[model samples]
Target: MKLVKVLCALVLVLMLGQQTVFAAAPAPTPAKANEHSSTMKVTFYSDSLHKEMQLNVYLPPNYDAQEKYPVLYVLHSYKLNEDHWFDTLKMKEQADALIASKKITPMIIVAPRIENSFGVNSSKELGYEEGSGNPGDPGVLNKGMYEDYITKDVITYIDTHFKTIQSRNSRYIGGTSMGGFAALHIGLSNPLLFSKVGGHAPALFVGDMWAPLKNLVYPTDEIRKHNDPLLLAASQKLNKQSIYLDCGDQDDFIAATKQLDKVLKMKKTKSYEFHVIEGGHHDDAYWSSQMENYLMFYGATDHH
Candidate 1:
């Protein structure tokens, strides 16, 4: 069944003539009075894609040229670009508050523009256009190469170009919805890269679209195996890394989150945290409410 779905997706990509699509520009909104971070949009060459990719960097207030700080790689949801969180969610304000209160240590936040590839890259057989409307091929482009970009290109560029703590224990990665899935996959697979991980309303089940599209696809052993984070978490014993997983009770992914929690308990993973909030699958408002909690767990407050 999973193979069939992959085949269908391949056909669709072929018929669609893979191309990039950009989202509509967000409405101009004034930054909050208290928000004082500086942002710069820069482009870098992605060796995996063999093209220049744009990314936004947010530097905290009072940034010093001589002092190095931790880095947080923030990924956005499906159909959204790097500006999704900053423009719509006011992540800068949240970060500012946390920094002012000394809850989360001041750090640089990197947001990359993944376009339509669902944070993935494109390849010859599975080309993807950023912001493309097709939801069938999540990682079709770059041949599911989002993980490589984050770990290799993004991390290397930031560490070399900026004053960053260039170590797993001082670096963190996370996102919401589809981005959350990316965070979980990348963090778990490359435990040596990031010491902390966080996900909010992550699209836990990806390869198996049955839960979302009944007529689209059916579940198979392979599909189930690929889409299960619980299985992924159970297979790895990341004793040094800390994980933060949370979902609103009313979220559509709540059941899957609960199942993952059960699996973590069974595995006796000591460095895991789960939270069930009283909310629904809403917008950045929901995520903003929980931002502080994630920051705290990431040890952004720890001076050591």
Candidate 2:
């Protein structure tokens, strides 16, 4: 009986020792290739909208805490959320490829959800300040002061949390469709915030669209006047560099983009590139094809 009791005690001790050894083992290192690039979703409170908002940030493959990086704010389409560019379009993959190949500079890309706010300080008449619609909802909501949310809240959050090259020259903004329109509006209206602007298939509209817009979001004529990129360009409000406008030749908005291009040329803007690509349409494939161009435009600078 004593011998059996001793043997049982020894077994228990050995098992406990093995468990301790395993517990003390260090975690396995993540693969180096996997460490090169990463994406993170972050949420923060937006004083502009009095709500908590979320955004996805893409860190370059070589992102380093000790180094500062240029930032590009990529807005999403009207119906899509922030992840549209990162997930659906695989924009982060394209960015990773460009950065790894040294075709473009390594930079951080921020995609913020703006819903149908159009990134404008819309009119009080539109009820963008008193509704209960969520971020990606198609209806109007009072919590959709997206311009303020983006320019102030989102930008501030990123700059505070990340090692960013904090300067207008180091920042760029771009988007598609309604997002494209908002990108132009935000960049042009706040030139000191973004040095470069790229509008892909921009939804540039005239007064005829305002009547329909009222039911959609209720924008006052004054808000429309301020958000119009063409008017801003003609009025000399667009003061950013390398403002590129690209649209598919077959895109319905091609005519408006062309007119804007002409206006910019007539204004003799120092740095603007307008291109109507062949066999291009207002769709994901077309935008995806132009991703390289967009990356080049934003990352082809000395800062990059």
Candidate 3:
């Protein structure tokens, strides 16, 4: 009977020791799927656009759902889809490498398929656009309320769905070509929406090359001025916003972009960087080549 009691006591002690060991083990970290970073194509409804809009979202490496992350909204060029950044620009690989090297802080990137609205809240013409029935049929081509679509619906969706920092200081906006034009316009006009605005080969409407496009998008001078980044930068006090502009020296939009650089400098618009890449043109080649610079501007260090 004494021996049996000793064995029971021994078992109890062993059980307690095992429990302690188990308790000491660390709990699994969250967001294991984001260990290497990932991107997903999301098709969501937009009240502003009044149609199903497509977006490409990139979650950075080791993205913890429990942790809030800065958001970078990178718009695509006209006629381009949200996947342009991740697929064509190789943003994923570049971002991955950059984060791995600690060259920039990890961030959540939101790229949306912004149709040809010139990034303005204008008229919604019905034509053959995505989410419209029949590909060859004339569907909703340009949903005019792009400004509302992005600012209201898209931002809200991202904020609610993702673990976003959800602060103006933590937000950034950027684009290429026509998208560049839109990014600058949207970022500068909103002022408080984003901490940084980047435009790669933006169409500032000064040069003859962009004049026609500008005329087509902006119905009146008042509307044009409201959406024009150059005018906004010159007039509005964008707080301490950081503006980034880059274009290939050979690109046609170089002149107007340079003019913007000058205006920003003259205004002493807090902080800004303008670069003219040699042999760079207003194409994916130029934009993709400078992905490093772009990422650095948006996520380099922990500005937030």
Candidate 4:
């Protein structure tokens, strides 16, 4: 009987030891797929333009509405709709990767469709001149007032509907090509609205003739001075906000962008950064490659 009791005790000891070992093992980290980021197609009425505007919003992985996140407004290139940023660039995937790795602070991305309005309140007609008119081409038609729609209407909608840090410091704006131009123009025009503005391969206007298509936008020298990014930078109209400008070496806008850089340098603006990346061009591959750089710049900080 004593021998039998000893064997049973040994079994209990072994069982307890195994239980301790199992309890000490750490749990595996959650997979990124389990917390995959999500995209929502949202449409809201814009009182500014007197119409409903479509927007694509990206919520970071494992997003919780109770938690507030900073917002980055990324404008699409002219003629391209809001989906171009996410569809062509795979921006949500990139954003998820950065956020999951903690390379960038988790934030929301908002891409609003502007109907090729150049992101401006061009003339009284308010909207882009579609049909027959190419981007940067003259003889265009006006449809709606987009600048107010984006800055005033869309922003208001996001702030009211989502848990967003609705402050200039938490707000960032960026785009490629004409969207870049719009970013520079709108971002600079409202200094108190955006903390950082990035222009990726911006289609900056050096003169009216540089882009015959832009005549449809600027239409006149006075309007050009007021709306053109180059002119705004030259005249030192840019507010005291962080400015980021980069263009491809092979991009046709390089010369004009360089001129803008020179003017910014001459103005002694120390809060701006300009780069001429090698083998870069005004194309999808080029923009896609720069997404990391753009996110790092925009998401570099978590505070104002």
Candidate 5:
């Protein structure tokens, strides 16, 4: 009987040990699935154009109606619609992951269609007139009222509808290629509106419009000098504002970006970040991979 009781006690000890081990095995890391369901198509009338523009808004997971989120305005490259930024760049998935991992704070992303205007503001309609002007010139279509669409119309619509933190520090703008150029131009021109700016493989320093077209209404040297980002940064008080610039090392515009970096440094702009990744002029893959880093930088600090 004594031997049997001792054996039973030993068995109980072993069973408890097994239970402890199972408990300590660490819960399986939750599956990293893309489970974003909050999405909507928002339409707002543009008072500037007296027309309606469509935009897609992506809200964070478990979003609460009482909470206000920072706004990220993403502009697309030429020939690409507003959906291109989210679909091609895979931004929705990336944003979900970053928010889940706490790498970046939850924010509202607004993407609007510029309709191939290249984010410019012009008085005439897009595209060239047949013999009346330079009919098939690629530069003619790039000149339009896209800048106003982004800065005035789209922004106004977002502010009036969404529960966004309406302040420069809570707003960020990002884009790629031609859209990248627009981001830089608009961000610098209206510093009171956006406190953060980023560009991927941006077409910076595109020289004068004359180089791209013969009859283009190029800005005068004085106006061009005022609008130049590198030049503008020198005089502007970019307090609490940040800039991120990235481009592929093998990109054709790498040299231009490098020049911009040099100018930033010369002006002692300490708030700027520049990166040259190893790759070519690739598309979504490149932007998707770098999106997290840029978004984190944009939302890292609580300027409010």
Candidate 6:
């Protein structure tokens, strides 16, 4: 059944090819269409990580510092940093157009640099010493306390610095692939902090299949117990969270995403949406194409 879906998606992609939207960074400085969003590149200190981190914020056009707005925190895919959303995906330009045309409400987009930490903090077992290596391996300084870095430092920074709504319902979190998996874990774990959680092409661990991530992110069954989305959904109540889960039919993670959707439905969360995008794959092309849908969900739709 999944193979059939992939084949169908391939056919659709061939039939109606949408130009891939990811481009080189700095995005060629989009031509001013009308009133456009103001962009800010910020670098701030993360007490949790004990280092300075960077993020991209896109403020809505005609942004009034006094006017509070909702904030959407987007996580990029694996290997790629926050620049994937701002530069590669040209999210600022897209958001400007969407808000200018009133297709979606004006809001703030915050894309942070989360490297390969899998959106979680490092284990104390790993040396906190600064070293050069990939995560989960010896002699790697992947930064300790990533979960705290994001959940505490990042959130506190955004709220304190920006004109945000400053409420759980006004804050949103979503991501692609590894970032998606992290968003799911974090959002479910801290339901009072976010009312909406979206996972796009999330790299989920099914059952008994442990690969690369296990060595670093989920080293033990006990660690997986807390971070796994399936376990979290089964154990935690998502009653106050509006969840969005999507993947391309051709993507390998579709099956896992579907399973998560099933679990969320069984739990009878506040809301749930599972989308298998046609002609979509687990690549930037698919994610870039779905930006409109993503924006609509985050900006225009009513979570209540």
Question: Which has the greatest TM-score?
Answer: 3
- Please, what are the lDDT tens digits per residue for candidate 3 over residues 19-44? 99999999988645657898999999
lDDT (10s digit) by residue, model 2, range 123-144: 4233444444554456543324
- Per-residue accuracy of model 4 over 95-128 as CA lDDT, tens digit each: 8888777889888899998765677776555444
lDDT for residue 242 in candidate 1, whole number 0-100: 80
lDDT string for model 6 (37-109, tens) is 6777899998887779999888887776337999999887776888898787777778877776678888989
TM-score of each: 0.75, 0.80, 0.85, 0.81, 0.77, 0.81
* Minimal lDDT window, size 10, model 1: 210-219
Q: Which candidate is the best by lDDT?
A: 3
Q: List per-candidate RMSD values in Å.
A: 24.4, 9.3, 4.6, 6.0, 9.3, 21.0
Residue pairs clashing, model 2: 36-61, 128-142, 129-142, 130-142
On a 0 to 1 TM-score scale, where does candidate 4 land against the true structure? 0.81
- lDDT by residue (tens digit), candidate 5, 103-134: 77888998887654546564445444223335
Better by TM-score, candidate 4 or 1: 4
Q: Candidate 2: TM-score?
A: 0.80
Q: Which 10-residue window of candidate 5 scores lowest in summed lDDT?
A: 209-218
Off by over 4 Å in 2: 1-34, 123-143, 210-221, 237-240, 268-270, 301-304
Give per-residue lDDT, candidate 3, residue 191. 75
Residue 168, candidate 3: C-alpha displacement in angstroms = 0.2
Q: Is candidate 2 or candidate 5 better by lDDT?
A: 2
- Sorting all predicted structures by lDDT, with the top scorer first, yields 3, 4, 2, 6, 5, 1
Each model's total of backbone clashes: 10, 4, 3, 7, 1, 1
Greater lDDT among 1 and 2 belongs to: 2
Regions of model 6 farther than 4 Å from truth: 1-35, 124-143, 207-212, 301-304
Q: Is candidate 2 or candidate 3 better by lDDT?
A: 3
